[model samples]
Target: GPDLLTFGEALVSLRSAGPLTAGGALTPHLAGAEANVAIGLARLGHRAAFAGRVSDDELGTFLLRQLRAEGVDVTHVVRDPGRPAGLMFLERRTADLTRVLYQRAGSAGSALGVDDLRPALAAGARVLHLTGITPALSAGAREAAGWAAETAARAGTLVCLDVNHRSKLWSRDAARAVLTPLAGHASVVVASDDELDLVGAPGADEETLVTGLLARGVSTVLVKRGGEGARAYTADGRRDAAALPVTAVDTVGAGDAFTAGYLSGHLDGLDLAGRLRRAVTLGAFAVAGHGDWETLPRRDELSLLDSRQPGDTL
Candidate 1:
């Protein structure tokens, strides 16, 4: 049994060097919010497992092999012959911006359901990490996300929910309806500053939203502020950490990296300040390179960001 478990739609990403209209070359990479977190934790030396569905095609095989090579357990992943795997194209339109186009409707990953979650698997892990993107995949996937969280909570496994809302998948209203209740089962909730309301009151202020979640039994609430850094609120107190000053080449997976770092810190029994520091450190690594999990730091490489000079080499 792994220490941390996560499940969602795994994707084959095609990254374009320029606009799609100026098609030259497409670089392939494995991607998924939950899978990215699993890889991040694995890179940091944690036992992480990922459960989901993928097509029985070569792309699916590639995804599985990539995850296995990263030390993430893929025993629960199903290879469906009837459906194709999901795909997303990352168009690097400019130096500071990247546009994503999705073509994942009716994909195999979105076919995830309650039956895919094994009770014993959920019970065995110390933490079950979920994200808002899973529930947005389909009705069956949504039900599976809720069931996994509830089952994990009942088994005394900590449930960590990352409200990684995607406007491209579902509307805000629809997302709130599903994610709010799902959050109830979570011991820890991670969301961006704008996404806080999805798991909280729609129009509530920041403090009010955080307080409301805490009052409703959520043990820890983490709000990610992108370039502004992040904040963690708990019964003990609130802690804030500034984002590392790094030139971001791609900001796609920074949040998942942060979540992985925070969860890793918690598993290591680190204090709140220590957790926030590690979270931001991992986030900096993610944005400092291309692809989703490609630039994630290993456990030993965590302090390199703090000590490296502009031209310093190890």
Candidate 2:
């Protein structure tokens, strides 16, 4: 495939290893749900392009530099005169706890609309990857997200939506309103236990949950659970992956990593079970690193995690 287009915001994140008052190393890096997936696919030697609005300010410039540095096509990124790229503060507690404080309100990314969608993306994409965060941004962004999904589907491209439920961003009713309809346009929908609850899926069980999404028109639904593996369902049946063991670090972008890996597998024509297994493994690899994109492994590095058996020593 020649194209994988992801639409969302890119933030200028100030990352620290510990509590803010206590003081830790502050590093500037690129951060975003879709941006993470773009970088992840690029790391795996796939074609990934990002489409979003960024401020013409310093933060926006930094984000562009970051994505371009990783070989992501950034032709669709635009800078607004009045708005700026969003900001986030990432604090790591212990090795596993990671918290983010957001400062994105009416930021440039959130201000994007359907008219801003690049014609190249609308016409040339092979897959449309989106998340729950976009529609929550604002009315314009929500419309742009839906239009992108619909356009990609009409172009015969597979649409993959990650139902990444973020409570701080918007209300359950609002999220359900936007997500339920967009899910109808996707061939595959990815979500977690938390996302399922927010949208009022049929039941807690995978069968019922996936059935609900299928009724909404998503043929493939994957429910991801941290450290507990993932359950994947299609028209045929469902399959599960055994979680891979890894020492946890920051938990910020593991779900995004899972989206990156599983979608990569999906594009490569991997089986349902194989895609879930790869997704879980890739997510574990993401936790083993420092920043979001810094730790994402290339295709060769991904296999190293599975080299060990149960009895093997680290």
Candidate 3:
């Protein structure tokens, strides 16, 4: 029914407007790995749907409106009758350092279960996007993610898994155990170099790490190197793209933006090199923005980062 179907936790992000010590106020925005990807794909002109649970509260209403404003279909989103929506707070101490705090334990999103996977919501999408963070939420959420992946795999839909490990949720060992098999089932696996350890390859070089994931049956392994840019490995060959030079305002959600760019390219039938370039470009856009998904580019706005002539105007 949609081009992309994503399932995960969408939370209210209360990020500090300035340094936490000298904070004037905390700005609220929507934040989630899968949600960010859904918004990014929608921005790029794809029909994307997000399925998740939120509390029937003001925060939940805000989240729904934000997703809808981004053109993401929230038809499958459920509202928890009792528990409130989850919350995440970010405090930036410096340009390169940000501390994240979560108020999500026992929240509605953490309570996601296998029953949440309605067949109609999971089926017929060109791609099913998931994240390791969901499985780390709880046993039920883990089962739900696995069920979604298996269902997508059966339908020959590409299952994209992003290994977004959070130490606060589970141990590295536990994450490795649960995420390794899930990665094997994913057609495409995205992970940061540091996060690769969650899939059992801590401290391994990019090539070694990608090789390990490829052996697990993943068709493509995208190694996100933060400021260094990203590298893609596939059965046919590998391609790398250097990060663009941009003054980053915030680094959060850049990886999700990168994943969206790659997926967009995949859907558009771009070559490996072209895909990597698009991924890096989108990532650069994220870091240069003030909020997570605020600066993600649409197809036409992609050239915003390109050098402009002195007199150029719309």
Q: Each candidate's TM vs. the true structure?
A: 0.98, 0.92, 0.94
Give me the runs in candidate 2 sitting further than 4 Å from their true place: 22-25, 93-96, 199-206, 309-314
lDDT values of the candidates? 0.92, 0.82, 0.88
lDDT of 2 by residue, 136-170 (tens): 99988988888888888888889998888778898
Each model's RMSD to truth, in Å?
Answer: 1.1, 2.4, 2.1
Score residue 259 of candidate 2 by CA lDDT: 86
Residue 140 accuracy (lDDT) in model 2: 87
Which of 1 and 2 is ahead in TM-score? 1
lDDT minimum window of 10 residues, candidate 1: 115-124
lDDT of 1 by residue, 86-120 (tens): 99999989867789999899999999999888743
Candidate 1: stretches off by over 4 Å: 119-123
Pairs with backbone N, CA or C atoms under 3 Å apart (clashes), candidate 1: none
Q: Clashes per prediction?
A: 0, 0, 0
Give model 1 RMSD, 1 decimal.
1.1
